[model samples]
Target: MPFVHIELVAGRTVEQKINLVKEVTEAVVKNTDAPSEKVHVILNEMQPENYAVNGELLSQK
Candidate 1:
């Protein structure tokens, strides 16, 4: 079994996420020989206000 965690800024369309998950699953399955059914992918979307860099919130930038 393979578990993949992906984190990114929120706002992507559903089609983008669908392609991402499908491509990611294909990669994992090819590289690790993990069964497609056993592979898991979790996507974490963070609001701009919740992320920061250089002491400044992303929302502020």
Candidate 2:
């Protein structure tokens, strides 16, 4: 089994998530020989207010 974790800023549309999972699954299948059913993909969405860089919140940037 192969597990993948992706952390992204929140607010992506459903379509974007769909495309991301599909494309990532295909890549995992090709590189690891793991079937789609055996590959696990985790999407961690964070709010801009909850993320920061260089002492500045993403929402403030």
Candidate 3:
């Protein structure tokens, strides 16, 4: 089994996330010889207030 973790700032449509996981699964299957069913993808969506860059919170940007 192959595990993939993806982190992004919250605010994407369900359809977009579905496409993302689908595409990612295909890529992992192609490169790692992992079947779609055996590939696990974890999406970590963070709120703007919980993410930061350059010492500044994303919510404040």
* Deviating ranges (above 4 Å) for candidate 3: none
Cα lDDT for residue 11, candidate 2: 91
* Cα-based lDDT for every prediction: 0.95, 0.94, 0.95
User: Model 2: which ten-residue window has the lowest total lDDT?
Assistant: 32-41
**lDDT (tens digit, per residue) of candidate 1 on 1-61:** 6899999999999999999999999999999988999999999999999999899999998
What is residue 34's positional error in candidate 3, in angstroms?
1.2
Q: Rank the candidates by lDDT, best first.
A: 1, 3, 2
For residues 1-61, could you state the per-residue lDDT of candidate 2 as single tens digits? 7999999999999999999999999999999888889998899999999999899999998
- Per-residue C-alpha lDDT of model 3 across residues 1-61, encoded as one tens digit per residue: 7999999998999999999999999999999887789999999999999999999999998
**TM-scores of all models?**
0.93, 0.89, 0.94
- Give the lowest summed-lDDT range of ten residues in model 3: 31-40
RMSD of each: 0.8, 1.0, 0.7
